[model samples]
Target: MISIELFAIGLVLKGPEIPWWLLALVIATGQIGGKLLHYYAARGSIRLPPFLRRKSANERTGRWREYLEKFRANCHRRPVWTGAVLLISAASSLPPFAAVAVIAGWAKVPLVTFLVTGFVGRFVRFGALAIAPGIVIGWL
Candidate 1:
């Protein structure tokens, strides 16, 4: 949910003071770690607060849950497509990776699939962001 682009760009601008790949790895690790927590929470491995549970049962939440159920059905029927969506969300944040994580967890997506896709996507995303400044400066 939080945007870390500025921080990553700042690290890149440090000009060899920090390794870009290392920065990308650290950022990706933290991002995936947080998403994993969301996944576990949605998977029922972590207990959510009572208020959250109550809110989730509301009409609005119910509607969203219904939609998510459909998505889960599709995930089972089309795993490769689901993985592609997850990868895109993880890398681009277009559909919001946090929401995707929750959806994947609720869908009971294989843990290995979630972790591997998430890490690879996040690494690529952050790595690109970290390197962008240098590439642009080179152009200038």
Candidate 2:
């Protein structure tokens, strides 16, 4: 967790030499941290902090109800996939973090699944960015 925070700090500081190990460390930390946030919300141990608690949470919860209409659902069904999707969305800024995290919490998405999915999603996304640059640059 601290390492992830440090990564963010390093980004802000414009420091060089973000090691490969730190990159993996941060992604793993971020995924786990995101899952814990959802779990705590589900367990009722924590209240949504002011930024996270709002009409948005309720709105997303309502949206999840709509998703449930399709079939029986629980947090565990595709933890890795769901986590990947949510984290990918968050990482890519496709959806607001609060919407993703809060709805995921209410949906009871299992910790393990989300962690796996989110990790893979983030890994693939980042990995693609790392690996595809040469191919992309060549096309230009």
Predicted model with the maximum lDDT: 1
Kindly provide the TM-score of model 1 when superposed on the true structure, using C-alpha atoms. 0.89
Candidates in order have lDDT scores of 0.89, 0.56
Model 1 Cα shift for residue 49 (angstroms) = 1.6
Predicted candidate 2 versus true structure: per-residue lDDT over 77-133, tens digit per residue: 655556656767655646654466656666666656555555655565444444343
Candidate 2 weakest lDDT stretch, 10 residues: 125-134
Model 2 pairs in collision: 75-108, 75-109, 75-110, 79-113, 79-114, 80-113, 80-117, 83-118, 84-117, 84-118
Residue pairs in clash, model 1 = none
Model 1 worst lDDT window (10 residues):
54-63
Off by over 4 Å in 2: 1-13, 27-31, 43-84, 123-140
TM-score of each: 0.89, 0.50
lDDT (Cα) of model 2: 0.56
RMSD of each: 2.2, 6.4
